[model samples]
Target: MNGKETYDKLKEMAFGEGIDLFRIADADCFLDSEYEGNRPQDFLEDVRSVIIIGSVVPNGVVDPLPKGRSQYTNTLMAATALLRVASFKLARFIERTGHWASIVPNEGSEFGYWYADKDTLRADLSVKWAAYCAGMGNYGINQLLITPEYGPRVRLTAILTDMVLDYDGKSMPLISDACGDCRRCIQVCPVQAIHEDGTFERFKCKEYMFSELGGLRCGLCLKVCPPGSGNP
Candidate 1:
């Protein structure tokens, strides 16, 4: 298939497999602001395009805050799994077409904690940034991609391919301070980690998760986000 044909097919495959959103971005988007020591070129030297795929996080599964732990974890895990399988499938298809494809890990890295900034948890190949670059969404004050449909309630995975596809060139406008003087996420945070400004204390939040949630992820902030929280 030609480049456009291949791109269309991949989008079909992703949506058929339950992907909530799919987008393509030029790999040059990461040339300047890569996380840690990893760059987009590091994944595939010949990479010309990045495929971004994401799935929605069910609001019902995260609405009750801490009480929804089991459901939330299951939903997140399933989203991650689907993204991985889709990435592998797309990568194999690209290889069969005589091109190179590199599937970035759905989870940033095994040692993500090591690089998690004390100010805000960030790791290599940040899926959030990739999604933004792909015109998928923009960042909220809480530092997560806020899609117009799902807000921050989404999980994303990326695929790097050598096939040159048309780039979207940051089509989505910046969300810039969409929280609109609202501080629900900050107010609901049990650990007081989120500041009034657009940043948060990553260490305090992580500690709260480890101690109270028994996991590295706590949905308190996500639970209170108006855009994605399913709240009226």
Candidate 2:
């Protein structure tokens, strides 16, 4: 099969496997001079595309936040778990198609993320960037990928592959167009971690979750990200 054919098969498999969101991002998007984060080429020199997959974090999960945080944390873990399993199958399928594939870890929004660089707290490469390039969603003021279907209430993972799949989409503005001057996320943040300028202090958010919340994930920034529209 060709690039488009392979992409369709992979999309079918991903969506059939219960992945609520799927997109193919031309790996070239990672080479942008503006993206200072790690690159997929660093891990796979021949990488040509990225498969972005995810499931929405049901509104139910976010509604009880700042209260049932333990449950909220576990629910996010559950979504990550689902993504990992589906990603494994997708990676194998891509490899069987005569191409190499690497699954990017979905460590964001987890408790005590072991895979992230401790000092920087970033994943090996930005799956969120790949997702953005694939047009799955756009960034919010809170620095979370806000999908039209679920706003920032989504969990995502990605597969870096050498297969030259048809790039289904192109990158847009770093932040969502709908993210106007709404600073609700910044206001609700207990640690003042989120900023109005679309930047944030990772350590501040991390410390608040780890030090004060006793390791339960904080969802305040997520809670006020005006669902779907991205503005309050």
Candidate 3:
């Protein structure tokens, strides 16, 4: 199949496998980043396209968070695991087409994350940025990818491929500058990790998560965000 045909097939397969959102971004999407140490090309030298896939977090799982943390942790774990499986499946499919494909590590980065100095808490291959480039969604004030369909209640993972695919530019727009100025997350936050401005204090957020929340996951902001709550 040709590039467009192949991309359509892959997108169809992703949605068929329960991916909520999908898009193809030209490899150059990461070229303009100020930091060059971990661009998409850095991982796969021949990569010509980036595939982004997302899954929504169910409202049922998030609504019960204040009562306990197990539901949130379990739901996130399950969703991320599904995303990894989807990435692996997609990569294998791309390889079958005589192209090289690499799945980004979901949990940790190959390059160590420097939290204090750089505020890099998680992994390399910023799937959030990739999703934004693909036009899947934009970052909200809370520093989470907010989709029109699901607000911040979604998780994403990506695949880097050498197979040339049609770039769709951006299919989705930013949900809004602020989530209707709800500010529930900013108000509920015990440590004041989120600010009125889009800037987030990740270090404080991390410390609060570890010290107070027992390291499961503190999604109070995610819970109160109105966009993904089926309101929008």
Q: What's the count of clashing pairs in each model shown?
A: 0, 0, 0
Q: What's the TM for model 3?
A: 0.85
Give every collision pair in model 3.
none
Ranking the candidates on TM-score from highest down gives 2, 3, 1
TM-score of 1: 0.84
For each candidate, give its TM-score against the true structure. 0.84, 0.92, 0.85
Residue by residue across 1-232, what tens digits does model 1's lDDT show? 7768877999999998888889888777778453343466764577788899988877777776678676777777788888889889989988998888888766521123444544545554666676787778887666677776776778888888889986665666555456887778788888887777656676777677667767646777776675444522
lDDT of 1: 0.73
Sliding window of 10 residues with minimal summed lDDT for model 2: 223-232
After TM-score superposition, the amount by which residue 103's alpha carbon in candidate 3 deviates from its true location, in angstroms, is: 1.1
Query: Of models 1 and 3, which has the larger lDDT?
Result: 3
lDDT per residue as tens, model 3, 1-232: 9888998899888988888889888878778553233576665678888898878877887787766677777787788788888889999999998888888766411111232235466555667777777777776667677776787788777888888898867655544555765788789877898887766777787777666777667778888776346423
Q: What stretches of model 2 exceed 4 Å from their correct place?
A: 108-113, 227-232
Ranking by lDDT: 2, 3, 1
Over 49-152, each residue of candidate 2 has an lDDT whose tens digit, in order, gives 88999887877768867888888888888988898989999999988877888888775373225577898877788877888888988888888888877787
- RMSD values for the candidates in order, in angstroms, are 3.6, 2.4, 3.7
